[model samples]
Target: MKSDMSDTNNHGKEISDDAFATLIRNQFQLESLGERLQKIENETATMKDKWRRGDEAMRDFTVITITPTEFTLGTE
Candidate 1:
């Protein structure tokens, strides 16, 4: 959620009438919006998978042992 890049400024760019109209039209189209939403959902699912795998790896490396006297920490 945090980005290292600064905000971008579109000061020097030029857009033709057709291109601008197409951009505006796409914003209002249901099909285009649905496709975009689907893409975002897929990306989110992929990130969650990666996080799950990382957690599993960390658990695999961690070992916690408990006894009557004290607790011990180790890696396997």
Candidate 2:
């Protein structure tokens, strides 16, 4: 009877340790996701600004395409 009671106590302790480890792992995963989202947002904003500048510059550019051989560029 004493040996059986010790076995039960060991099993309970193992189960409790496993639960704690699982909880920590879940928290780490959540933090990683938050960091990735922030990076994506920053990159998106930078790209948007670059696109706007390129569009503005193109509007001020002049087309001077030469026939089949060469070309020149000027701002108008």
Candidate 3:
């Protein structure tokens, strides 16, 4: 009877161990995903900064058109 009880307790412990392993695995996966997201966020900010600077530079550009009879200057 004592051996049977010990066997039962071991079975429960095995289930608990499996659950703990799964939890650890999930935590690692979540951490990896978080790191990837952070990298992407940084890259996006850099791209946004570049785009803003390019837009500002374009804002100062002027276009001129000259024909035989007319000349036109335009800012865009």
Per-residue lDDT, model 1, residue 59, is: 75
Q: Could you give candidate 1's per-residue lDDT for residues 1-76 as a string of tens digits?
A: 2222222243545566676567557766978889999999999999999999999878765534345346445733
- CA lDDT of each candidate? 0.67, 0.66, 0.67
Candidate 3 has its poorest 10 consecutive residues by lDDT at 1-10
Winning candidate number (TM-score): 3
Off by over 4 Å in 1: 1-28, 64-76
After superposition, the stretches of candidate 3 with alpha carbons farther than 4 Å from their true spots are: 1-15, 63-76
Off by over 4 Å in 2: 1-15, 62-76
Write model 2 residue lDDT over 1-76, tens digit each, in one string: 1122234435534445555566568879999999999999999999999999998777656333344345435633
Q: Estimate each model's TM-score.
A: 0.47, 0.56, 0.60
Deviation in Å, model 2, residue 50 alpha carbon:
0.5
lDDT of 2: 0.66
Better model by TM-score: candidate 1 vs candidate 3 = 3
Clashes in model 3: which pairs? Answer: none
For model 2, what is the alpha-carbon lDDT of residue 29? 96
